[model samples]
Target: MPVDEAGAKAKGGRKRLIAIAVVAVGMLAGAGGVYWYTQRGSADHAGEKQAEAAAAEGEAEGGEGHGAADADPTASYIEVAPMMVNLRGGGAQAKFVKVRFIVVAAEGKTDAVKGRIPVILDALQPFLRELRPEDLNGSAAVFRIKEEMIRRSTAALGKGMVRDILIQDLIQQ
Candidate 1:
């Protein structure tokens, strides 16, 4: 009878320990879930609030009265004339490249860009003339060329006058 009682006490102690461990695991899991929810949920809520505010403001300002162009006043595009330049291939290999691109300018600034096209071309000609056939071999070269043109165009036309250079056609021979 005494041995039976001791066995019961040991069994009860094991059950209590198991229960405590389960409770501890549950609490840790709950805490982790709450932390994850708070971190991820806040960004989504912020975006939703911004969108709602914009919609409310637009409604208040008579959204239908404003045209699409007026709603977001960004630059428009104007195509520049195609340019053909002789690339300096090593020795007498004689290579030529043709490129055509559009210039992004603020609304009503197309005419100014059009009038200054010659200056833009003059600024770009030197860079194009210096390119070797191998220099424009891959996509990386094309990206570098676009960046250079953007830098040159912005420099020639003053900051903000030219927004970007969009390549329309590029041919190498």
Candidate 2:
């Protein structure tokens, strides 16, 4: 009876070992699948970028005579004149801010966009003056400032006129 009991115990231990091995294999297979899926996505993204670059190169080589079609509609940019404003919230001493930017406009709207610079400045001045030093501390802050500038410019120049705002310079003293 004791010999039979020991044999049963050995069989149960073997079964447990087999179960653990199977679970480990399953986990490894799942990890491998996830890794393969992510790598596949990255490969696809790289392929797409390569395709785009190839298309751009082909256009450059083949579209030399088609000047109108070759022109990028989003290439027009209107430079905003430099602006200086006194910043608020710096105790008794006044902190000043200087900023210069470019407004990206639809092609052929350079003159109209340039004419609206004063209005854009008017919209921007108040916001610039109100900014505290802490508000412009990082990339996120700069992005927020650009977005605000775009919104203000769009409001002043009407929707779809200004595509983006490029901050040329920003200084605080």
Q: In terms of lDDT, which candidate is strongest?
A: 1
lDDT of 2 by residue, 78-144 (tens): 7778998887774665767677777777667778888888888898988898888657554355556
Give me the runs in candidate 2 sitting further than 4 Å from their true place: 1-74
Please give me the total number of clashing residue pairs in predicted model 2: 0
Model 1 global lDDT (CA atoms, 0 to 1)? 0.72
Q: Model 1, 1-173: lDDT tens per residue? A: 99999999999999999999999999999999989977785665455445544543443243545223334456577778899999986655466888877776766787888889898999999999999866765445555676799899888988867766666556665
Q: TM-score for model 1?
A: 0.55
TM-score of each: 0.55, 0.56
> Which stretch of 10 consecutive residues in model 2 shows the poorest summed lDDT?
61-70
